[model samples]
Target: MDPVTFSPPLYKQRYQFVIDLVKKYKPKKVVDLGCADCTLLWKLKFQTCIEVLAGVDINRAVITDKMYRLSPLPCEYLQPSERPLTIKLYQGSVAEKDPCTLGFDLASCIELIEHLETPVLEKFSEMVFGYMTPAIVIISTPNAEFNRLLPGLNGFRHKDHKFEWTKEEFQNWAQDVCSSYNYTVEFTGVGKGPPGTEDVGFCTQCGVFTRSYQSEGSLTADSCRDTEHSYKPIYNVVYPNLCDGTILRNTVISEVIYWAESIRKNMVECAQEDETVDNHSYQASSKSVPSVSNISQETCSTEEHVLTDTRGDNEAYKEGNTIFIPLAKLFSFSKVQKLCSSLDHLKAILSETSQVELNSDATAMILSAVEDIEEHAEACWDTSCLELGVALAECEEDWDEELCDS
Candidate 1:
């Protein structure tokens, strides 16, 4: 099945909406359900001062170190700052009952529930309301009522989406959940709708549920346990230190950071050994040939030999440089600086593009630009650098492929 790809504009709106809510709520413990690539977590970490951030995705592939590094949101973005973000990653389906043991102040599942079958969604509601009741729950799903706004849009926005609820259907569900859980819910739409359909004109609908004061006391961990809800520790961080792009991409920031570190250490050791050998040779030559005439002849011969071997040594050095200097100037410092600038530009593109409707042509251009960056990063042969590019490129490629599928 083809994967679902979200538009840059939609992503921006979703992020901003969630970010605004986070700012308003000021929840210290945040949980992101279906946090694929943990994209929002990276944003929230910088945008807010959340004490604990947890990401749970059903796709186990995303939990692996390889995918985590290659799945966008670079290591530099997830770095330690003056106000550090303590992040935890888990792999498990949200359909499971009380998937996580820890309590959260706020929970968000953006553009996720539609992908689940109706039955799973029912269980999900139970999991969220009946068992893992947080103080606040925020959800965003595609609005079936607004599919008419999309050009050539058919059936559902994505094939994986089991169903998209109309505004009434969504409101009904929200009201039912709130009533059952003794919570109060509010509604908002994400995208611009037709002029006449202002109230229900959004491409996506959002529901924010805040538990009532009286309900808080009854919704405890002990109460959840009484319901036979057992929390599983299936979610784990195979690689905790996924680089966020603040550090040099060549260092210990990739899936292969350990290997790269070892190779770099060996290279340093080899260079040191070569320096020692050269020093010993110079000392031995000076002691053995004490005569001034001999020294002079020796110096003349060495000069002559160096001049003769210079061209050959250069050719040999160029060939041997890869082995000797893995981190050695594959690309100039200027090039890396330019690449960093280009990445900053790409970030601008992401922000700017989100404000307007995205087309296939624009998507192609964006993907091409990201690929160009990735290609340059790959030349450095640093997994951290290469994977940063890989993540961006993959994100675009997935979008392109999904567009084709659409």
Candidate 2:
């Protein structure tokens, strides 16, 4: 049978609905109960509000193969996360009580309930809503009522689905679970039918169950940090954040190098324009010095933060194949407004790191044996920031593979 596809696609719509909930409630800890291929877990990692992310699936092979997709991207370093985010993928059954997946703020089961047998479903209800008892529970299942709207369909949507609950059946089951677990539920769905098919509801039915912790003395996240150790470790990674000294040093130095490289490219362009007006203005053989024209003098040189060469003084200088970039010019480069929000924030971070230091007057940022990026650009723009590019690439490659053994 051909796979059933929706306008936005049923799975995408379902994941988006959950992402919207995550944005609204800002849950710090979230776990996907039946993360088959980990597509949902991969998407949730981009949501910065979630600090602790986890995925539990019975299919260990799939989790192990796809877990690398959850790692931090290279751009994440240019602007680090405000809060640290750690992601873990576990191999386990949702029916069993697992300490590794416990005490989450939000629990998600997307199109997973219908796949469970009746006996397993009962256990899942108790384990997820009763023992774990997260503040919010989101569950989505295929709506049997909407099956008629699908083309060339049969008894169930998928052969693996033991049963598909009708709207009443799903809601009644939800209400019963809420009543048993002391929680309230909100009903919603994704994928609309034809204009007049409102009565049948969406293609995928969802229930958002919320409850406030009572006097039963629920488990705090720290309580189950280790205890039976129910879920088997698959992969785990902690993203680089500013709170650590070494990570901060690496992050700051890389940012400064890239920033300086970008400004150097612009400087080369301005120097070319200045060299056009006066043939003898710049002598690369003597030292890196470029004369400034009236337009440059009025617009850039007098800005106090832009490069200065109007009076024959070089804003950037070369000595024995080493070059220095003025911190004032780099931090105030007109183009950097798009790259950084607050230059002061970078300055503070730099001061905290010992790897890179400012000159005595704090006027220049001295990088040792820095090759001319202009030469690297002769190959391509990609090679211009070689030092930073290699650093970031090495870091990302570490996260590109499975982080845990078995």
Pick by TM-score: which candidate is best?
2
Model 1: worst 10 consecutive residues (lDDT sum): 362-371
lDDT of each: 0.61, 0.75
Query: Clash pairs of candidate 2?
Result: none
For candidate 2, the clash count comes to 0
Q: Residue by residue across 1-406, what tens digits does model 1's lDDT show? A: 2222345577888988989999998988888898887678767765545867777887766555333432224444443233434566666778776535347888999999998888999999988876678889999998887776566787888988899999899899999998887889989867675456575557889999998864444556576665543332332221223234423233322212233333444555677898899888878888776754645677888987785577432121222233221222221234433433453433333234221122333221111111233343344345444554566566557656744553
lDDT of 2 at 268: 58
TM-score of 1: 0.51
